[model samples]
Target: MRRSIAVCTLALVTAVGCGKTEPTTPAAPASGSTSAAKPMHPAAATAMQFLQASAAGDLSKATGLLTPVAVEQLNKQGMTIAPLNVESPKFIMTRFLVTEENEAAVEFAMQFQIEGEQQEFHGCCVMKNIGADWRLAGVIIDPGNGMEPVVQNYEQELSPPTTNPANTVANPAGGQVPQTAQSPDVPQQR
Candidate 1:
């Protein structure tokens, strides 16, 4: 009983730890700024808004600007993909540079917990102008963590890759149980 209690406590702590929120600089001003408020560009503003929504797991707001195909794909995988994130991102404004194009690109960094795993997602996203709002076109999820191709951060090193784990069941006792979606409770990792 004590073992089980310890495990459950650990699991909950891990989950809560990963879900902690971080701050991010959405944009930077080009010239002498009066206030701390960043100047807004319709295109860049649209792009940043979409990213913020996505990062917060508020997919509905983000998808309001998505192309049809993207929406459809997400819906089809809705069971497995929770559009909500486990945590918020902390972005460095100095690195938040925007490109000049109908296609908008912003490079930034963020770290958070999702499903008990703490991860830092840093990359660039390309946006296409869809009427007034910006739509996601392409994303580069890998910037590489100065180590190997797959080795980006320590948190990743600690977790196992999401390949098919041989049949492992969850114990009501859950220390480092490493619960993947394949658990009997979670119905759609496949």
Candidate 2:
């Protein structure tokens, strides 16, 4: 009797398991149909595409995204315009300012490791819309130290004028001290 009960339980479990069906995956879209993907902004799309091509070591495709002036500048600098041999290349968008309806300025930072040493590079690209396509108008690469002097000069230019020699006061030693150096609240000792 016990053996018959055990066989009956085993048969019931097998029957229940066999009644279940596997889940099916959704079918892929047709080859030419990209209707499911979201579209990107023209400037951002072009810039990202250029960076991806460069990272993939496709020099021709990358250069094709640049404007004629940019290509000429690269040639003038004697640069090979090839993909940099970097490990773990990262592109970061810092700013995207639209100056006009069809013009924009894009600032980005790139970080990567070369020869095991990590480095960061900053650049700004001007993009212009030509017909329905966005293309690079110009590119400026910074060595990370180029803006210091410019900022310093601008600050100096904006600062108020320094002590004028015409407002000098004679000290005990008959030396002239600019009025700015002495506090007006304190009387000078003759």
- The C-alpha RMSD in Å for every predicted model, in order, reads 16.5, 24.4
Best by lDDT: 2
Model 2, position 176: C-alpha lDDT score:
50
Candidate 2 displacement at residue 106 in angstroms? 1.3
**Cα distance off (Å), candidate 2, residue 145:** 4.3
Query: lDDT tens string, model 2, 1-190?
Result: 2222222223323321212211222222212223353444567557656665677687888778776656666666555455755655766555555556766555556777778888876655556677787776544455454342111111011333455534444432246544466788999999
For residues 9-116, write the lDDT of model 1, one tens digit per residue.
233233222222223345543221234765654544555565666666776777775555556665664521234344455432223223333444444445566688
Model 1 TM-score is 0.45
Clashes, model 1: 3
Error at 84, model 1, angstroms = 6.0
The pairs that clash in candidate 1 are 23-90, 24-91, 57-84
